[model samples]
Target: LAKTTQPISMDSYEGQEVNITCSHNNIATNDYITWYQQFPSQGPRFIIQGYKTKVTNEVASLFIPADRKSSTLSLPRVSLSDTAVYYCLVGDHGGDTGRRALTFGSGTRLQVQP
Candidate 1:
């Protein structure tokens, strides 16, 4: 597993775009970059994922540079409901045979001010 570093907090106005970046310089070859979003007490939900280049889903877009040392999660037109903690993880996805517990650290908290 690779260690990841992200911002502790960010402030954004309602209906504004927000981008959160995470660094993982020592990522392994089989490791994948995944982004998750959490609202208060709820469990984190998958936001986006990318090995390289850019990956866009309904909720967010993940941008990975060529070096694969870091990634950025882009949220368009964020609202108050989007205020939450975002986490970036770099690891191997254990489908069934390789199941493993996730190690979580302090994540980036985004505050949307109305």
Candidate 2:
């Protein structure tokens, strides 16, 4: 597992675009970057994942550089409900062979105001 670093906090207004970046300089070849969003008192929800290049979904887009040292989660037209703590995790998806460990950082708190 590679340790990740993210902004402690971010501010955005409704209908604005918010980009949160995570740094994982020690990432391994088998490692993948996964982003999650979580509200207060709730578990993290999967946003997107990528090994290299860019990946986009209905909710957000994940951009990873060729070196895989960093990734950015882009949320377009965010609303008040989109406010939450975003987490970036890096690990090898060691398939169903056995259990794997997941380490979480402090997470980036996104505040979406009106």
Candidate 3:
């Protein structure tokens, strides 16, 4: 299984933009980069996913370079409520085997202040 790297913690003020970068040196071309955010005891929630280039939704944006070795998760404007643990996951989104699995490593704890 491939692994993703992220900081242990990040701090940001309210109304600030926070960009967290995750590195996956051994990421495969067939794999997709997915991000999930977890708050306190809750389970991780999907933020975004991309294979190449850029993908954006109502929550966040995912940016993958040409090499696919690394990706960035960008949060537009963060608030105190946005404080949570961010996870970078790399895996095959699906396969013809009729099964889909995604594993998330220990997450990056994000702290948002007033």
Candidate 4:
């Protein structure tokens, strides 16, 4: 498991681009960067994922540098409704017997203020 570092909290207004960065200094080669967003009481929702380079989707974009030590989650034109906690998880979600259950560490709390 790769340890991720993220801001404990963040604030933003409506219609703004928000970026949350995560650091994984000891990330492994097979580790994949995956991000999830959590609301007040619901389960975390998958946002984006990438192994290396950049991956884009309708929701967000994941940028992983060559060294794979860190990753960035970019939200374009964020709104107040997007306020939630973003979690960065790194692990091999493949069919590895002991790797199936990855622990959920801390997550980045994002507050989109009106």
Candidate 5:
């Protein structure tokens, strides 16, 4: 398991693009980078995941470098509703082992202003 570091907080206005970067210095070969967003008193929602290169979905885009040390979560046209705690997790989720589970950190609080 690798420890991840993210911003403590971030601020953005409505309809602006926001990019949150997470650093994982000890990432493994079987590891995958996953991003999640959580609201107050709620479970984290899966946003995106990538093994390497880039991955894009309707919600967000994940960019990973060839070194596999860090990743960035890009949210386009964010609104106030997108404001929440974003978590960057790295693990191998292939089977039903304990590695499938995600460890939640303090997360980066995203504050979307009007």
Candidate 6:
């Protein structure tokens, strides 16, 4: 298991871009970095993921450097609705392990102002 660290809080205005970076120095070989976004009372939604290099989706883009020790999630033109908590998780989810639950910590609280 890899331990991840991210910002505690971030402030951004509407129509601006926001980028949150996370560091995981002890990532294992089978570990995959994943990002999630959470609103006030809702569960964290999967944003993006990458084993290496870059991966993009409708919501955000994930950028991983060659060292594979860090990752960044970029949210373009963020709106007030985007204000939420962002979490960076590293692990593997699948197979007959029969365990699928997100262990969340104090994630980065992104405040989007109008």
Better of 1 and 6 by lDDT: 1
Alpha-carbon local distance difference test for all models: 0.90, 0.94, 0.89, 0.90, 0.93, 0.88
> lDDT by residue for model 3 over 1-114, one digit each (tens)?
478899999999999999999999999767988899898889888888889999999999998889888899999999999999999999985668847777778878999999
Per-candidate clashes come to 0, 0, 0, 0, 0, 0
- Over 1-114, each residue of candidate 4 has an lDDT whose tens digit, in order, gives 778888898899989999999999999878889999999999999999899999999999999999999999999999888999999999986665654756577898899988
For residues 1-114, write the lDDT of model 1, one tens digit per residue.
Answer: 889999999999988999999999998777789988899879899888789999998899999999999999999999999999999999876756888555666999999999
Q: Candidate 6, residues 1-114: lDDT per residue as tens digits?
A: 678899999999999989999999997777789898888888888888889999999999999998889999999999999999999998866447847665566889999999
Task: Please list the residue runs of candidate 5 whose C-alpha ends up more than 4 Å from where it truly belongs after superposition.
Answer: 94-99
**Model 6, TM vs. native:** 0.90
TM-score, each model? Answer: 0.92, 0.95, 0.94, 0.93, 0.93, 0.90
> In model 3, where is the ten-residue run with the lowest total lDDT?
93-102
Local lDDT at 32 for model 5: 89
- Per-residue error (Å), model 2, residue 95: 5.7
**Model 1 alpha-carbon drift over 4 Å, by segment:** 94-96
Model 2 lDDT, full chain set: 0.94
Error of 1 at 55 (Å): 0.1
Each prediction's RMSD over C-alphas, in Å, is 1.6, 1.1, 1.1, 1.4, 1.6, 1.7
Clashing pairs in 6: none
Candidate 5 lDDT tens digits, 36-72: 9999999898889899999999999999999999999
**lDDT value, candidate 3, whole model:** 0.89
Among all windows of 10 consecutive residues in model 2, the one with the lowest summed lDDT is 93-102
Q: Which is better, 1 or 2, measured by lDDT?
A: 2
Where is model 4 poorest over a 10-residue stretch in terms of lDDT?
A: 94-103
